[model samples]
Structures are given as C-alpha cells and as structure tokens.
Target chain A: MYKNILLAADGSNNALRAANEAIKIASLSNESVIDIVYVADYEKTKEDVLHASSADELMIERRKKIQNVEKALKDNNVSYKVTILHGLPGPEIIKYANERKMDIVVIGSRGLNSLQEMVIGSVSHKVMKRVYCPVLIVK
Target chain B: MQSLKQQWFGNVRGDILSGIVVALALIPEAIAFSIIAGVDPMVGLYASFCVAVIIAFVGGRPGMISAATGAMALLMVPLVRDHGVEYLLAATILTGIIQILFGIFKVAKIMKFIPNAVMIGFVNALAILIFMAQVPHFIGISNMTYVFVAITLVIVYTLPRFVKAIPAPLVALVILTAVAMFSGFELRTIGDLGNITQSLPSFLIPNVPFNFETLQIILPYSLALAIVGLLESLLTAQIVDDMTGTASNKNKEARGQGIANVVTGFFGGMAACAMIGQSVINIKSGGRGRLSSLVAGSFLMFLIIVLGDLVVKIPMSVLVGIMIMVSIGTFDWSSFKYLAKAPRTDAIVMLATVIIVVYTHDLSIGVLAGVLLSAIFFVVKISTLKVERKNSHYIVKGQLFFASTDGFIDYFKSTDINEKEITIDFSNSRIWDDSGVAALSKVKDMLRDEGIEAKVIGLDTSSQKVVQQLDGISSSH
Candidate 1:
C-alpha cells in the first residue's frame, strides 16, 4: 500500500511530517519509494512575479529547501527523489501522481483558510471536489 | 468591446430558429395576456412590438426578448377592469413612464431586494399558474374544457423536441383548430368571443384613468409590475449569460427595463417585461446580440399590421396550444417538485402564494402574501434566540442576527426587570450579533432612563472562566 507514494511537499512543517511518515512506512515495507514534488501556481501574474526574486535564485533556494527535506529523510534512513513543476497547485500535484502511477498523494492544507478557500477557491478544495485519486490533506 | 463587435451580428441560423420559435410563442401569449388585461389580442401584439423593439436595441443582455407577459397581463386586469380599457391604456402608458423614470434615476439597484428564494417561488408559482390557466384550452370538451386544452398541451409538449423547427404551439393550434372548425366541435374559439379588429391597433393617448385615486389604487399593481419585470429580465439575462458565456450587469438591464417601459407607455401600449420563454427559445435557436430581439419585434409588428385579420382567424384552441407550450417552457417543474418536498415553511409559503393567486385572481396578492409570510418566518426564527434567565442575571447567546434583534430587546423589556442591576453575561458567546448589539444598546438606554444598573458582563471577553462564572448564577452548566 505504501509503494510509490507521491509526497506533495509545499515546504511546510506539517507536510514534512506526512512526508516523514510516508517515508518511514515505505522503508518498513522495503517495497515502497518516495517521489517528492512541488506544484507552483501558474496563473500567478506579473505583479505577483515582481514580489519574488529572479528565477535562478528561486530555483537555487528551492534546491536548498529540498536538500533540507532530503537531510531529514536521510536522518531517518529513507529513500526518495524530487521533482518541481508549475500549474494549478492541486490539479498539477494530482496529475503528477496519476501520470507517474503513484499510489497516493499527500498535501498540506495550510495555505488557505476556509473563507478564502470558499471565495478564491483553493486548489486543495478543487482537488478534493474533483480529483478521483485519494488525497490526504495534512492540517 | 472587441468581442461584442465580433459576436454582435452573424449567427443567422441561431437567430432564425429563435425568431420563428419566439414569433409563434409570442402570438398566443401576447394575445392571452392582452385578453387578461381586458384588451384585444392585437393590443398585446402592439405591446410586443413596442417593448421587444426598444429593449432589443437598449437592453443590456443581447438575446433577452422583452414582450407582454401574463404577470403584467394579470396586473393590468384590475386596472383595466375598474377604469375601462382607455384608462387602463393610460395607466399602462404611465407605468411605462414611471419605468423610464426609474431608469433615468438609475434605480435599478433597488432590484436587489428581491431575494433568491422569492424569485424561485415566483417563477415556480408562475409556472403552476400558467399550467392551471391553460387547463381550459386543452380540454376540448366545453363547460370548463381547459382540460382538453390540457390534451392539446400534452401533445404540444411531448411532440415538439422530436419534430424540430415546427413550433409546437402552431402544430397544436393548427391540428386542434382544424378539428374544432371542421368537426363542428362545440368548442369556443377566439372569434366566438368577439370579433378581433382587422384594423391595426390605433394609437391611443396615455389617458389611463389618471388621478391621485387611480395612482393610489394602482400603486401595488405597479410595484408588482416593477418586481415581476425586474425578476423576469434579470433571470432572462442570466439565461443569456449561460448561452453566450458572458456576464450582464443586472442593474443596468433593470435600468434598460425602466427605459423600455417608459417608451412602450409613450407608444400607448400595455406593460411589457422580459419574456423568459421566448428569450430562451431565441438563444437556443442561435440568436446572438440584439439582432434577434429587434428582428422579432419588427416581424411581430409586421404581422400585426399586415396579417392582423389572419391572426384573428387563428382558433382559441391553437392559441391555447401555444400558451400551453409557453406554460410548459416557463414551468419550473424541477424547482416546483423540489419545493414541494422542501420544509413545511417553504411549502406553505409557496402553496399560500399559489392559493392566493387562484383565489384572489391577483398575482400581487399572492406575492405580497408570500413576501409577508417569508418576513414573518424570519421574525419568528429571530425571536427564537436563546435567552437564559438565572434569577436576576441573564445570558444571551447565538447571533442577535439582523432582522431578529428588535424582538430580542422587546422580549427582555416585557419579561424581565431590574434595569440598573441586571447583567447580560455574553462572555461565553463567540460573536456580537450585530442586531443583538444594537438591541442590547437600546436596552441599555431604556435601563438608563429607568435608573436601573444595566451592565454588560461578557461581551467579547474570550475568557473560558466567564462561562464558569455565569454557571454559578444558575448552578447548571
């Protein structure tokens, strides 16, 4: 059941907890492997783009962030690889899971509050509402 | 603007399909409603001409068709009944003038008062009323043969989709009228009632029995017109939205309604509103932009002018068939069925409106009753706010939600005492119900007048111990 688990990482602590739990369960099964991924919201605009640093610097920082997670996985003696892509965060994450034939996808529910989720319409809510695959939204 | 220009014209196939359907649809509805308004069927056509034309050009929603509707027709009855057709025509003209004034004053924002439930109630009730009204036309067997009209209704309803481009009403009218005409069926036809004028509607003055008395009498009628007009147009605009995948500013459309009414009145026609049945037919038939509506109005006018005599020859059964179709189209069966299964309050309100409409022969009466009942329901729910009384202390909980706050204050004033010494422990409460706060403030003022110590103990104090402290007064959790 734990084999080929897709860990939806948002560089959040609780997502890390779920990721750690998935890795541990996978290592214990000895047949499971972890696929780490981050989904960027592609609909973000130029004004939004201005708020962030240049692409190369952002990629470098993302790499460092993954390394931190990788170190945590290593400390627990778990095995994994990472991928980063851009699109509507929830759908993209689920699409990646489906495309890669991963068993399950794990995500963090920290980005949006319920009211904002209702209005701006959260990716996780959309995923929960639309996606056929099983998704765990860690609080 | 670019998209508007690109899609504004063309779409001939959709337009023609919708146009023919609307034309067939409008003939019966326009005539029936006109009859209901105590006028010749052609006057209904004249109204269809004026409103459909003006609104087509000026309307915010491109595909929405404005024409005489049963709702407006029903409203016109009393006005026409008491004042006679001439005065009714004057009032109709004035109604349009008032609508135009509404537009010029930019009063479309006022339409927001009509809520979703009420709107749903309106359309659903209207659908029921339409079907009920058509009962006599379908049943060919006279002595109250709206039932045979029902059979013609059934055939028209069931056969239309399978037989494309052939409007159902026309089919029903032709087949049924032929049967009635040739078979010498003891059924009444439009010609039997009175001779429809072969002459086109003569331009008349806006001389609706004008006076303060007339205005006072017709105020509610006009208000009903305004409400029904606003609701139908707004809803039709929504349909147009779904068709074109575009959004319309409803308030703007309402302003357009006001302007259209004013113009229609200026032309000495009856009150007109957005015809949802025709509008839907128009859109689904491929009408886009204002062209279809304009074409429809122009065509209707052309028919009334050139083919008035032939139109008068169309049997009442055929017109009934057309109305039966319109009734089915406007009938919100799904919503009606859903409402039937809804809560007792909802069901009661809907049924009450329906009953009032049937009994009073007034749409406004039904709607007013429905609205009032809805208001009463809100007040009852508001008044039910939990008030825990413990000796000299009181704890108010739940939202002192708006529309309910005044009742809460009144309850305390009537039942409780000690204006100076009373404590309202709201510490356990999570929200300061806006209405509740206003009510509490009012209570505080009243207490001040009586020289009572009115103290608010737990308003917005998020301390968990406040709950325990309040419990000490009642000695219960």
Candidate 2:
C-alpha cells in the first residue's frame, strides 16, 4: 500500500491523469494520503508579479495551476493536502519527495510545455532519475 | 558536505569545458570594457582574472561568473578620465569596502523592491550603452574596418550552428585576426588602443597621497561604483539562480564581490562585477559549479600569458562586432512586447529607467529614479481609499495615507448626504500619518455643513488612537 503518495500537479491534462493514478494508489490503504505538490517556477515571478494587479491576484494565478487536480481529488474522496513549492519543477519536486521520505511519487509523463521538456529534458525524467522513492509515471 | 560537493564539482567535464568557453568570451569583453574605462587593456584583463578566481571560492552564487563588467566600467569613465588609473584603483578598493559593509548590513533584502520592468529597462539601457561605446571604433573608420566587422558578426552569429566545441566570439576573433594579420590589412588594432604588458599582475599600492583630499576625490566615484557593481552582481546571481533552479547566498556574494574587487584593486586592476553575457554562456555550456568559475579565471590568465602577443594583433573592428553582439544579447528584446502588454505605470518605469540611464550614462542614478518612480506608482495603486455607502452608513476601505487624503476629503465634498445621522465606518481601513487624520476631520466639517451629523463608529483601536491624538479631534470629542 502506497501510504505516503506524492502527486506532482501542474494543471496539465497529463497531471490530471497522474492525479487519478495517485487516487487509485492512495485508496488502497486507509492510512494513505496523497500530498499534492505544485511548483511555481521562480523564472516567471517577474512576469507574473508585473501582470498581476496585486499579491492576491498572483496567488490566484498560481492556484489556477492546481485547481483542476484539486477538483479531481475532491471528486474521488481522496485524502490530500496541497503544498506549493517555489523553484524549478523537476529538481524542487525531487527535493521535496526526498526530504519528506515520500513512499512513492506519482507524476505525469509530460507537463504544460513539451518544447521545454524537449530542450532541457522533462521534469518527470529528472524526478524519476533523482527521487529515492518509487515513482509512478502516468502517461 | 554533501551539498557542498554537489555545488562545487557536480559536473566536472561540463564545468571545465564551459569554463574554458567562458574564459574565451571574457577576453574580448575584458579588453573592450578596459578601453571603455579608459585604462590599459591589462588592467581590465587582470581585474577579470582576479575577480573571477577570488569570487569562485568566496561568492554566494556558485555557478555565476563575476569579472570586469561594462556597467562598472561605465561608472569608472569619469574617475579614470579625471584622475587617471591610480585614482581608479584607489576607488576600486574603497568600493570593495563599501560593498562588504552592505553585505554585513544585509542590503540584499531590498532587492525585491526592484520591479521586473525596471530590471528589463536596466538590461536594455546597459545594452544601449555597450553599443554606444563601440560606435567610434568601427564607424566610418574605413571600408576595410566595416568589412572586418561584418565578417566578424557573421562568424559569431552563424558558427555556433556548425561548431559546438569552441565559443563563437573566440572563433570570430581568431579567424578575423588571422585574416587581417596574414593579409596585412590596414586596420585599427588592439595595440593602437593601449600597450598591454605581457607580465602577470602584481600587488602594488595605488600611488595616490594618503590624505583627506584623496578620499574626497575618490569617495563619490567609489560609492557609485560599489552600488552599481553590487546591483549588477546581485541581478546576475538572481538570473543564475533561476536558470539553475537553485538558491544563492546573496549577502555572501555581496561580500565576495567586495573581496574580489579589493584584491583586484591591489593587483593594479579596475573594479569588476558579474558579466551576464558570459554567465549565460557558462550555463548553456553546462557549467553548474564553482569549479567552472575557478577554471574560467585561471584559464583566462593562462590564455593571456600564452597568447599575449597574439591578443595585441587582434583588430579592434572584430572586438566592436563582438561587443555589438554582446549588446544585442544583453538587451531584453521581449521588453518591446512587455511595453505593449504590461501596465501603463510599469511601462513608464521601464522607459524612464532606459531613457535616464541612456541619457545620464549613470546606472546608479537611472536605477534610483526607476525605483523611486515605481515606489510612487505602488503607493498610488495601494492608497485607493474607497468610501462605499450602504444606505445611511459609509464603509471606508484600503489604506488611508497622505496621498489618498485629498481624495478622501473630495469624496465628502462631492457627495450629498441625505441622512440626518450618517455613520462613517473606519473598520476596514487603517489610517497612516497626520494627513489621514486631518482628512477625517475635514470630512466631518463638510458633512456638518450639509446639515448631517456624522457619527463616527467602527474605529479600530489604532485608528481611534490616531484620531484621538490629533489636536482638533480631541477638542471635538
């Protein structure tokens, strides 16, 4: 039973599929809880802050990235808590998973940007390569 | 220990290769910035080597490169022009001291105050400045100079597509210099600018009188240099952090830049800071550790010592073309889109920053103005004191500051309150300064003239305290 499941969500369609997988794994054990992690890349802080009317609006923008996944999780009755991490998606996800000694990580095979993934390798690839726990890649 | 190892030598092959590439890139830049600062090319070269090497061990950002930057050079033009290299060296040392103090005092906390618009403006302004400095070298000099420059640009921009082993700028330098030398083309060479001593830089005190007069002469320039140097350094570090998805010790970097500049000054070199162009080159080439910076600095010295004679024979037009490339790379071209898409105030701040820096040729002043302008815009944005009426009661919201006080008074002057007893609520808003309280008193007087008794209620303890403390309000109570 994957008791401590870490789900990486980025509002991508693939991430919703990953969340469904996380719910499947988490429901196996009564003690299990899927920890939903959304990483807001620091690279966009400048543009995001400039475009946003206020700090509240900036948070709303970031929250929108995980809104779909949260709704899916709610519909499944999966026990979960959302945590926002700041930095690069792949490395920060890896760091968070390792630090918490996550029993398993469930991430999507692709994210919002295929071009970035193609150029620098995907976040899932980096996470799968670096994370110490078992990683479930939902295509 | 685990993370330190990861930070230093996480990728060896990448670090060294990138380091070498960065070293090659630094040469033309170091020499070009030297000429811009009006010093001998060796001073800039020595400063780049010293700053890069020292910053590797001591700097807060591991992957970021620090060396003789054009921003610092632009700041130095007046100093070097007025009192010569000795005074410039003196100013460099003093600049280091000021930076160290800034680090100790944790000035890095204020970096968030620099909005993105201003940052884009700063980058674009610096790009404009870099291009402006290179104008006289190749402009209308000769048809030959123009040809060499065009060829250099072509090679630098296009060669990277075919060749991945070497840096494009170095390739441009080598190929163009060889053609000019072997073909005996009449060109303005680096040698024509200034004599470059082939020997290594040595420790020597600046030959300026140790008196108050000397301090008075260099202090202003030193302060300006320190501020601009640290600003650019911190900005570059932030860029590197975003690129690598890692955090940096910014305060430590401030001190490290100070230490590097101090050592560089003692070694008879001008002040230096982070070079963004070279830094991006390092990142793209797979540099991810302090070792890359170490290699970059040491390898630059190696190149200089082994190829000093060859360096002098290089045509200045090639350097001009490369610097033009640098300016192109340094400028945030997306800022054009940003101006169209961004808020009006943000656009103004960015444009103001660019125009002021380009006009004054002083980054510190330009940045100061941008920060001040942005601050004013921010205050104006947040101080939108809203007075919403719900029947006989008025609810006040948002910050009530001096800036919004006049508007708060005007709201009362314009509105005709029909209620005999109108309750003004201050529960949702906080009053700041005496002007806010004075505005409240003026509102009460205006409402009284309208034959309406304003019953003030919902005052938070702090707002009540402020209202009671005002002289007229105490008598009215």
Candidate 3:
C-alpha cells in the first residue's frame, strides 16, 4: 500500500536489511518510487570532520558508501533516487520525509540493549516517535 | 616579543578592572587556603601575588587567571605540618622545577587523552570539596554566621537578575563584609584564622639544609604539588579557552606556573596554581588580557599593604558565603539529568571518578581511575566487532584497533572454510593502527597454514597503503 518510500541507509548491515525491505515494498506497487537518503550525521562525525585535513577527504569517504548503496539498489532493480544530507540523522531524515510527503520510512535499528537504547536514545527510536508516516525498523 | 607585548597590553582598561575584581576575590580565598595549608595567611597572599605577576608575563593563556588554589592547598597540609614552612618552601621550589621539566617535555599535549566524562567528574568533585571545606565555619560558629552566609548566597544568586553591570559575588562580598563589620557580632575574621603581614614580602632562599635527607622529605610532596598544579592549571586554561573562544599555549602556561611557584617560594610563599573560581570571576568581569593578571597581583599586594586592617576585619562567614556560591556555580548540575541520558559506561565512569575523588581527596587518582575504566570499556566494546563470511568472501565491519586485534583473529579462526581461495572485504571498516595490520598478517598466516589461499580486497587508500608497506617488506622474505 506504500506509494512513496524513504529508505535511510548508513552502509551498515542493518541498513542494508532495511534497504532490502524497502525494495520488497516498492516492488509490490507499480507506481512506487524509493528515495534513498544517507545522512552524514554531523553530531557523530563532527570530530572526524574537524580532524580531517580537508572537506574533500570526508566527501570522498562518504561517496564510497553512497556508491555501495547505489550498487545495491541497482542490483535489486528498484527505481530510486539518492540524496545526501548533513545534520543529525534522525531529525534530518524525518524532516526530509515530511517535506517530501513520503508514505513510509524504512530505517535500521542499531540493536542496542533496552537500557542503552533508553539512555542513549537510538536514532530509529527518535525517528519512529517523530515521523508522521509509519516506520519499518529493520533490526 | 612584539606580538607578546600587544597581547599583554591590549584592552588595558578591561584588564585592569578585571584584575582589581580578581584581586579583591583573591584576598579572602588566599587567607582561607593558607588556613587549610596550616601556613600564615601572608604566605598564601604573597604566593597569590607572585604567581599572578609572573604568570601574567610568561603564561601561555593570556586571559586566564592563576592563583593559590584549594587543590594545591589541600596537598600541602602534611608538608607544612611536619617539616614546617621552611621545608614547604623548598618543596615549592622543587615543585616549580618539576613543572618546568613537564613543560620542557611538552606533557601538556597529554590533555587530549582526558575524556569528557573525566572532566565533568573533576568539576563536580571540586565543587563538592569546596562546599565541604566551608562546613567547619557553618557549624558551632555564631548563629550570625549562618544568617550572613544565607544573606550572601541570596545576594549572589539574585543580584544578577536585576543588575548585570557588576559581578554579583563582588557586590555580595563587599555588602556583606560591611554589614558584618557594623553588626558587631562575635564573628571570626581572616585575622582569627592566621596573621596577615602588612609589609612587602622579601626574597630569601629556603633555610632548610640542602642534603639527601632533606630531598627525601620534600621530593614526594614536591612531585605531588607539581603534577596537581599543572593538572589544575592546564584544565583551567582549557575551560577558559572554551569560554573566550581562544586557544592557549599549554606548554608555555606550564613553564609560567613553574616560574611563578619558584619565585613565590623564594619570597616565602606557599605553593600556588590556577583557581577556576577566580578565573571564572575574572572572565565574567571583562578580564581579557595579560594586563588583568598583572593588575590582579599588583593590586593584591597593594590591598594587603594598605588595607590590611580592613581586610582582616572582614567576617569569615562572608568569605564562606562567596565560596559556597562558587561551589554552586562551578558544579555541572545538568550532569544529574545527563546521567540518565548518557551511556551507562560513561555515567559509571563519571560517577566512579566523583566518588573516588570525594573519598580520597585526590584529583589525580580519580581522573586516572576514570581514564583507565574508559580504556577498559573501549576495549570491551570494540571486541564485540563481528566479521561475516559468505561464499568464500569475508566482510569485516567495525573498528579494527589494538583492542580488537585478538578478537579479529579469533573470528577468522572460528569460521568454517573449505574454499581454496578467499577474498576478505574491508569496505565497511577502518584499521586504526599497526596492531590492525599485524592482525591481518596473522589472519593470512593462519589461512596459509590451513592450505587456503587468501587475499584482502576493498581496503580504502589509507589501509591499502599500510597493507602494501607491510606486504612489500614481508614478500622480500
């Protein structure tokens, strides 16, 4: 029943699982288009960016992950467009999804334990709480 | 030197005003710290003056203030009590020597390894210590002391809400001191704690006989003083750098502190270091140059010389109130809320550091414990890293560092393999150091020993370069 699907990938295995789930959902509908997004997660990577000698170096590293995600989507024959955003992952993903009016969001759970997930507040949990659309969190 | 002059002389008015404010704050604090160290109040005052003046000229951090601190005071109680002031002076000079060596060795660079949790813990511990130090004055003293302390706290906390022009603590200290003088209560004053010298401090070498026996007596205390002094000074500089959005020359600051201590010792003063409370007060009062520190020292000497009688009469409870306010202001209260939100390991580290520091009254041990625990937790976390094997190809993900080397090898050993050739992909991971390269070598040797040909692929340029360097050297064998 999903028409517009937003898949958030971080190049991790969990994210790859979510991408697969999004592919399956898109394949079920003829008019479905998957918008794949990769958030650079500034809060998590700010130190790396600051320590790196040049912005070009960081961009090149990120491009490799994006290329891998693109290859995966192409191999699955999923009609998709790719976009990269820089900011906190959860809020940025939710904002993009809301602005694009995506019908569903597929995200990966980092599989933190209950205590850790409650304390640190996993990105998926934040997205699930705030996103307007239904969230499919792949563990 | 030209740039140094500019840095020192720039914003002269702000510096002078801030210096005067800091000097005022320093008087009661210096006297109080001297009492804690079991030395005459003049010793702490002279040390405050000498350290302030010398550090102003040579310190790495221009806008920061350094003076006689509670941390250094607490460390000196035994030395002053046993060997007397003469030996304490010798220890102070030696402490300066050791700190100079630390600067020469660039030990200030080690500040990077101190994690955020440890810093928060240090601040909290210091806050608790400062508060606890005031408890003696709170109990068994005149009931008037409590009233004055409450009045001072109210003025310190509420005055800023109405007027932002003056520092609230200074206003509170001045107003409360005057009130206590007029109220004519049987209040303990700075003079009640220790004698205050009105004459200028003169330079003289410590009178202790220089011998192996003397060295043995002073060395341990001197070492403790040196390390604790530098730790407090460097951490204060870091905090000020964050406050003023400027970087400090940590090595220079270390050397400056060393020189200040040596000079203070020669002038019959106790050991001195950075005071975070006074530095915050200076910053909040518009101090922004080396001149402010210069003024703080010169003005303090002037105050003691010219206004010694008036200063001695200021109630101890007034100082107690200001310190209590400092304790309240210095504490990272948000950490309580953060404890529930932060990772359990981090919370544990912070809590453990705070507890140990409070119990042992040793800042270094607490921080060391926190750093050690953080290292252990890091090792545990990285060891959980996994490598997935699929159809003669292995995908390694997660950080590969010294902590994870053995785990990486074990993961390779446990996987069932029958293929003649295998490719290992490292597209999703980073090899952090030489240990990682060594681990890869062991993995290849293990597979070779099993008669399976193995090759690593998908390494990023940096990792590829490391592997190439190692492989080039090994293939020649």
Instruction: Judging by lDDT against the true structure, name the best candidate.
Output: 2
Identify the leading candidate in terms of DockQ: 2
Q: How high is the CA lDDT of each candidate model?
A: 0.66, 0.88, 0.82
Write down the C-alpha DockQ for each prediction.
0.03, 0.13, 0.03
lDDT of 3 at B17: 93
Q: Write the per-residue lDDT of candidate 3 for residues B262-355, one digit (tens) a residue.
A: 9989999888998777886777677878999999999999989998887778788888888787677667777887689878998999999899
Q: Write the per-residue lDDT of candidate 2 for residues B162-206, one digit (tens) a residue.
A: 787798899999989999999998999999999878778999999
Better of 1 and 3 by lDDT: 3
What does candidate 1's lDDT look like per residue over B290-378, in tens digits? 77787788777776666656565556655665665666556555555546676677667766777777777766667677878877886
Name model 3 segments beyond 4 Å from true. Answer: A1-139, B163-167, B379-384, B389-393, B399-405, B412-423, B430-456, B461-477
Candidate 1 docking class: incorrect
TM-score of chain A of each: 0.76, 0.96, 0.83
Poorest 10 consecutive residues by lDDT, candidate 3 chain B? B468-477
TM-score per model for chain B alone? 0.77, 0.92, 0.87
Share of native interface contacts present in candidate 1:
0.00
Worst 10 residues of 1 chain B by lDDT: B468-477
The true-structure Cα RMSD of candidate 1 reads 13.9
Q: Would you list the rank order by lDDT, best first? A: 2, 3, 1
Candidate 2, which segments miss by more than 4 Å at Cα? Answer: A1-139, B1-14, B379-386, B389-391, B433-442, B445-450, B457-473
